[model samples]
Target: MGKVMLARRAAIAALLAMRRDDLFVVTGLGSTTWDVASLGESERDFYLWGAMGGAAMIGLGLALAQPRRRILVVTGDGEMLMGLGSLATIGIQRPKNLAIVVFDNGVYGETGMQPSHTQAGVDLLAVAAACGIGARLDVSDAQELHALAERLAHFGETLFARVHIAADDPPRVLPTRDGVALKRRFRRAIGIAS
Candidate 1:
């Protein structure tokens, strides 16, 4: 597996082991990283539009609505940068039930080749920490990720994990589903049917 996928898969497995039935996940296109890692019968996966940066906000809503439940947001670096302001809101809210994980592959993988904010020298963890969310960086192997997962279980703070995903082209798993169809499915997946 590629770097980003590897890290995400590890993280996903960790999330699954920690919480299965009482969790919420906000995920975008690049979430194929974690999707491939998810196991049988999980209704908690709230699929998101490629509407980059919206995932975290969605996670925030879920956390706020169900303040006692844990919410995890798996997003791409490109998408998070698109909605960086969401971090500020999350910071102010300080929802202890939320964790935001950004897979920093440094490219807008869904689109044609283009650099993301991370590639442009943006330290998202620093930016997030400045916004008041607890931030951490993961660059080591699977053991470190497992340890992080254990830590995630006990932290009652808004957490941000910036994972340095290896630079790889986005994976092709669902065949090239049309953009419109994908959006519709995503809306349904997240129960935002309109």
Candidate 2:
């Protein structure tokens, strides 16, 4: 209820630390991608360089394709808002292995920190619930982050969480920009035999 919020980098670090080794990650364009790559680039990570609103859908496809592995989509509030319809589609498909986490700093970090829909008082958790997502988690602090991390490690159903973070710009950590190499690496990581 106050101005205090989680640090974006720290939140990503904590969540990734709790993530299971095989949990496939699909990061939205911009900040979230840098946040995850800041930790360390991984072949399991399919970082979206330009798909502004396709992270959740990609996660859904991955979940459906690999039912045995977990899929986590780490995206920003701006990207999530752009891909709002994907939530409904995900709900319809109901991939039990997929989870979406929105880092809500309340602004478009990729652009110029302009206020986003979430900053305009949109309740993303409610949106996800109304869209038929099975689990809704609102995380703002350390305890809640821990709880969410635990659930992510052993998730049993479709999950959507909004993590409130500070709208501060940390130094960007750029990863490989070669989409072709990234695609090949990710495919090999998932054992596509190519």
Candidate 3:
């Protein structure tokens, strides 16, 4: 049988349910942002409207600034591929509170579900390990997702996770697009006076 595929929306919702208020989230360009926004709006979520491939770096910055809080970067494979170089930089920085989770549906959902590099033999998990992020995980099923969510609370090392999700486009549920507002609210949530 083919490998089991996870529903992106469901998986994201499951993760967010376990989220601690202080755990800041930085979302990537399209669906990943929408997936998080769909549940509800929160000051802790810094949703990137059009910033493709920049999520990981943003998370790294937040992680460094708020060493006591966890920073999670949730992005898609296509977005991750665009910012592949950031992985190397992240490894060098090695922020213990930062974790990046790529929702690998193997397609660029924003551009109409075109097959992406991941579909053509790019192994993101290996790339992450190569970049020196020692803690790597491959989550394909519900069990793994649950484990990943649980692990999110306790990780103190730079961690990378690739979640295999189905290439199904759900309705676009967008978050606030004003970048300035996003920055202000996120800053306030993290205890920084904006």
Candidate 4:
């Protein structure tokens, strides 16, 4: 598997092991990478449309409402940079249940090969820390990443993880469901309709 795929899988495995029914997963383009790693049944995985950074904001809402539940957000590096401000909101609230995993490909692969904030020295882990969230970086092999994921999972603090994945294109997966449909299903699963 590709580096991004490996990282996503490792992250998802860590998440699944911590399975809590109340937890929701807010994800974007790269979520499929993690989904492939997730076993059997999956949680509410929000497939972001063209909107970037949307997953993080949505995750914030879920975390706030269900303080006892964990909220895992799977997002791309480019997407997270788009709404870095949301980190501040999450930090101020100090929600212990929010965990954000950013698959940093160093480029906006989903929208063509454009450079990402990480390519420009935007240290996302540091940015998240500055925004008041506990953060860390994992750039080694899959084993190391899995270890880091374990450390972050039950930290009981808003955590941001920057995973340096090899920059590459993902295998084209068919969009079985559009954004609207996915949103509706996700909302129903999370007991939130809009």
Off by over 4 Å in 1: 1-11, 14-17, 31-41, 135-137, 175-194
Model 4 steric clash pairs = none
- State how far residue 139 of model 1 sits from its true place (Å): 4.0
Model 3 pairs whose backbones collide: none
lDDT of 4 by residue, 31-65 (tens): 44335334543436665555666778888887888
Clashes per candidate (backbone, < 3 Å): 2, 0, 0, 0
In TM-score terms, candidate 3 sits at: 0.98
- lDDT assessment of candidate 4: 0.68
lDDT of 1 by residue, 47-86 (tens): 5545666888888887887777778887888878888899
| TM-scores of all candidate predictions against the true structure | 0.76, 0.98, 0.98, 0.78
lDDT of 3 by residue, 137-188 (tens): 9999999999899888888899999999999999999899999999999888
What's the lDDT for candidate 1?
0.68
